[model samples]
Target chain A: MGAMDNTPIGGDTRVAALWDGLSRVMDPELDESIVDLGFVTDVSLDAAGRVDVGFRLPTYWCSPNFAFLMVDDIARELARLPFVREVHPKLHDHMASDEVNRGAHLGLSFAETFSAFEVSGTLEDLRETFHRKAFQRRQEAVILGLRRAGWSNAAIVSADLATLDRVVLEDEEAARQKPRYRELLLARALASTPSDRAFVTLEGAPLTEVTLPAHMRALRAVRINMEANGALCRGLLDARYGEAPAPEVPAHEPDHAAHACGGGGKACCGGCARQVSAFQPTAAPDL
Target chain B: MYTTPDGEEVFIIDGHTHFWDGSPENQKNIHGKQFIDCFYGYHSSLSPKDKLWTREQFAKYSADKMYHDLFVDGPDDMAIVQSTYLKDFYKNGFNTIERNHEMAQGQPGRFIVNGAYDPRDGEEALEYIHFLKETYDVKGVKLYTAEWKGESRGWKLTDPNSYRCLELCQKLGITNVHIHKGPTIIPLDKDAFDVHDVDHVATDFQGLNFIIEHCGLPRLDDFCWIAVQETNVYGGLAVALPFIHSRPRYFAEVISELLFWVGEDKLLFGSDYAIWTPRWLVEKFWNFEIPEDIKQEHGVDLTKEAKRKILGLNAARLYNIDVEAQKVRLKNSPLAVAAE
Candidate 1:
């Protein structure tokens, strides 16, 4: 019974650690992890401890830049594990699968990989763009939760990181939102000024009481755009694969504030009723 | 023409439609079937439960079905048929101009046929545009930037050859340029469908109207920002319109944002027929109301007049259809008389 007899579970533990690392990698557009999206189709380890992972997207024509990011991230994550001697990341059933897989394994950048095409910016530039959008999406969810819990717009705009953190810890709803929200906020904070407000625009402008409403409105569009895209991807993935992946989380619930505005649970205002009746189906012939 | 109880008439135009043949017989490979299957996914996901069509029906629906869907069974007064030729996928080319022109022949004035050209075809493509205009008298064209040809997966509007085509459009008197800039193509680059090129082209070709189909969706924010700055740019509501049912609130948000940025006059309604029916979409949109919160927050309004413009008037203006004259013609037409 030697202490060195832990070899049986050693490979399993390393694989589990590898998965943990991959979970941190997100499909930049959807802001969801590849694992949770059911994108990782296969994973294997050889006797030599070299690892291989395979993934597929919802479509044969998913954006290559985003595809490159995911495959590169997978290899990079596996490389960090001491026990893994070599990492092979494979992309399957994609339009550019050959180039992407070869490039990823050989450690070529996106521009180098697609030299035949005109690539305007580096992969980091693309990642940064999506990161900004993700930040806004995550921030909007947290703010919407706070507003539903009866926090005034003024109070939210004035709150600092500590205050927001306390709210996330104390409020059940906010706490549920904290995992994604705090994660994004922390990532952004590391790159900003020490005196900067916790919640800021993509340009690093602090939110104030006067600017809060406008900021919320703009971010609302970004949130809606992202959510709608996420829904479309889920639908396409289900269609392609013949079975929908179980959602890792409850679907991003719609804002409660919008629903609570009227007694009918419909968003239509007083003017809408009169306008809607004007073009009722009876106005046109029945099929 | 849809007549209100108060005797007010609303002209309806299905701004974007297609007569496609995606049957296995026509498919060059799995991609042909996959292309239409992708469309079917959208159809099944967003359509009203009762409106769903079988995969068999979707694969190669007859022209009779399309005509009835747009004219008799549906609410459209005039439908604009846009051709999308994916020669790399379909053997006869998916929804070619010749096919659209053939379908339009049976209906005459009831359909407006829009042709297409691939810049990758080079100078010969420009000559083909001239031939199409003279043969079909096409007033508009559909541009698929992400179409595949030979080894090249896609081309951009900013390309030299693409500019050559635009110059030809102006020379040929093709006023309306309908550009497809949404999801999926051979190459996987995000820029394959980037709306940025639209900005450059719209600025350069000020005379021709650039109708960004699907309103450059999945990039609505970017589209809006760019559209607001360009006077020649317009928004085509194809894939976006069906959302009025399955995702009403999100639909409201999309419409509100569009109204805020693109304004009602610049927005045109498109059924994206066959993928979706005009009847249900027209009905739902006619009855859609922007939530009070959204209106206040976005500082926008979706009034009945805005609905009128979106439903038909705006497109009528773009296509140069005199609505007053068309309304009179429809009122006395056999179909309207039969309905009465």
Candidate 2:
């Protein structure tokens, strides 16, 4: 798939020239040459040098802001050449979309088809995340109103996405309008899981440091909490090691709090200090 | 009704996470334990980005969503972080020390760093260990047995080189030393490794607050037996915990067994965050839908206090962090803005 055939465009210099022309018209968003990035799909050139070039949008339905920018770059570049007559953008799949492609293509050009206030999907993802964070943070309406009031980038990501479960937990009542909402609710439910073996017995001497001050680290919290709770069958081991001196290992930085998931390669804590291979299953869990 | 010193919540301590750049050229052989590829359920290639997830990315993604809500700066949060790459060490020095020391540093009882040491470097590794403590104020030290004189990429925490580093961690006050354990005799000898191989060495280094990296295959009870039997030894279920088909009760068995063996305090909190935990939780919701009550049975509290230790505190004390001052600073510390 990598090696490309440098087959010439044959006799028509315009066809070869059109191909050469679009390469320089690169996809601005990707920041790479368009031809090499496989964005330029097809190009047609007539004897009059009328060029019709087609391109696949970076996304299935990418906003055509960059597409039209390249369209103009093509027109200007081709118009500058001695032979070209007309230049038109030929979008194959994206332009035929239900909301965006068909709605605007009638009176508007591809570039003009976009809405200035169109909602960002990533922002929407962040919005949903903020809701979950608000609940986790107990912030409730704190930041939602901030975003609603048009604030800039600001958020509190607790726990690792690795430890978080991205489930749609919204019930039918709340999710009747938006089905995807259910998935979001379920995502954090997993977090409530005990992180270590949740020690219920309270056997150890009243904890050495009963209350922790506020200024702790902020690594994956929810997941670690869930993992810590889940990993525990009893409340806690005795703080006093009968024979063993305390490791006396000083504290480093706190990892993000509230995340329930772990990642690979970039795994934090060398795979969170415990990695059990699935291939070698142990005593079947009771859960 | 709900009141403990930490209050309602468990002392949440994360006890695990690594900070490192994917790039190899940070001038650190910390361990050629190159985190190359990971295979999870045969669908490893499903991810859009091929890069392995790191604590930084984990933090970047999870920061605002969870951290701000869960932690209050002081003992409210605790994390024991380790660095695989020497260049990737945490910049914060000992609690209230230089914020940019760039090595393993335990903050005002907040985030704590455990610097990685490669035994293959021999004396040089030992020297760096000293420098990390003396110069950077690194709190804890980390070593990997499988990483030393690595066999076909790796072997058990029981490996000889790992024992040497473990020797150092015990000698030093680096109690939070983490050891990695791969699958037992990975059918193809090429990938064969056993965490138990170093069991005897760990026994010899008794009293060092040692954590066996991966509980070495959750469902398997062999290592659990060792953790139960060993006096100074403790284990963490950082990865490969099956949460999907298993309900919260299903996990109780291993949790119960781990508690029965190592006792609860010895079992540190581990999410194996970037790699396994998130998906397991997702799959748990997808398949089992375990109830929250089931977790409470194990003494797991969803409230804020318990959240502190599991988040990082258990490791903090186990790591022997100064809990006394960490509490005072939380109220006055500027790093924390709001805490619920």
Candidate 3:
């Protein structure tokens, strides 16, 4: 269920739930799930309910702020799990691994974490900027999908949330991003009700037929930027950790025993060893 | 020079290349090792399988390999070898002008060595710019804004100290300013990757040409806006060009956007060598085309003339090279003679 696992199917709900939590956390800049991006390498829950999440980014020098955001998000998301007592998101190999891990553990704000660097802007501002981009990128995908489905620019710019909800896009990318776009759109209050226009600028201004072409070009720039960064992130991740076994896991008999660490299970054995080493109290920082 | 199927020779001026020793022995700390490893990641990731190099080879290659990779074997007619002195990361400094100039000495006219300076060094930075010009007679300088210096993670082009350095560069006739505004290396703040700084610098230093490397990807929208507003601004195709192999469609879309906004005359070819070679990139890019729909949407086309400009003509113009004269000189060079 997690990035490290060679198999797709697993029986342990506890560990799977941990992965599910990690999945909710994103790389902020890319606005993609950490799990989906192969950032989360190992997830294991001990008997004491202490969750240690092992992860690595595409590069050791990835922005420290982005690293902090992801690590902090991981902890926050995992805390939602019912049985999870404590969450430790272990970021490995990154230049800021120590600061980020310690900061996440102590619940320190990004400013407090690296106060020495004199971070110029607040993480909230950075987060907001990325939110706007994610909204735009996803919106572009959905809009392109509609355009591909033979919907005119007039139809798209004039369509309401009700119309968007009922849309059955044939385009795979648009269809996949449609719901995600809706979630962000509503979250950002760009559109709130069924009667609200589905397509609106990040500032909540509704798109007009005359402005649609220019607006689409603007959206496309955002889309292409995010897509390019996403591609680079995926490529770097694969290059950093020789490509992970195919992301898909095969469904088979649910072997509960095989799920246990050191129970001779191929999938969890390496993960379990890594878990033990990662959580060691005296684990020296690997340079 | 890259010869087309019809036997038309296309001169290539690779806008970016590096000669660095990121080997363990040179690494001052973990950041050093990780820095090169990250570059290796980019190398292994975007490069075709057959183009892959072993980690050891990538970490440190001989001078002969670099020359062959750029000239005798690769398609680059003239490679701009940019110096990046990560004194904090490597013991002897990574890819300093000393090393680049040493290598360029062998090839002479085939290499254009660009110098780099850390503005965070304050008055010393200004002195360093003078020193670069005095020593290398450099016409261009590469600014790696994300480079860490002591306690500072990065600096902006708008920084007061940086402005002073730019003034020195302007006076010294270092007309070309290549800034690394691509993906973050060790940035603590978003300002490092922000193209807004380029906007400010380009507008202020109208006399200098500002080439935003990587075309400020992930911030392409902002970069495009800036490039359109400022005529002196240009885009380097280092990190961006690799997409020709890994994501040709995305490359089409990006190139279309660049053509529409930055224009072919403002774009330059770069292999960002060692990470990727110039041979395959030049071949692939020459043959590539923006999808018809993208062309229509962007109202631009990647014409052969545009390709000729992007491949080398644009850069030759920036460096004040007379293409015909330089071609004659390069043809008579020792390497060219050896190849013949």
Q: Which of the numbered candidates is closest to the native, going by highest TM-score?
A: 3
Evaluated on CA atoms against the true complex, candidate 1 attains a DockQ of 0.23
- Relative to the unseen true structure, what is the C-alpha lDDT of residue A94 in candidate 2, on a scale of 0 to 100? 40
Candidate 1 structure, TM-score to reference: 0.84
Query: Residue by residue across A83-138, what tens digits does model 2's lDDT show?
Result: 66666655544422333333223435432443333222222232342244223222
lDDT of 3: 0.81
Sorted by DockQ (best first), the order is 3, 1, 2
* Cα-based lDDT for every prediction: 0.75, 0.39, 0.81
Residue A68 of model 3, lDDT score: 86
Q: After superposition, how far is residue A124 of candidate 2 from its true place, in Å?
A: 55
Q: Please, what are the lDDT tens digits per residue for candidate 1 over residues A165-209?
A: 566444443454556776777677632343345567777677888
Tell me what TM-score chain A of model 1 achieves.
0.75
lDDT of 3 by residue, B1-340 (tens): 8998789999999999999999999999988998889999899888887898999999998788888898878988899999999999999998999999998888878889999998888988888898999988999999998888877888889999999999989988999999898874746866446678888888899899999999998688889999999999999989888877766656777888898889989999999998999999998888887666567878999999999999999999999889899999988875823332
For TM-score, candidate 1 versus 2, the one ahead is 1
- Where's the lowest-lDDT run of ten residues in candidate 2 chain B? B37-46
Segments in model 1 whose C-alpha atoms lie over 4 Å from true places? A1-19, A42-54, A111-122, A143-194, A244-287, B3-9, B330-340
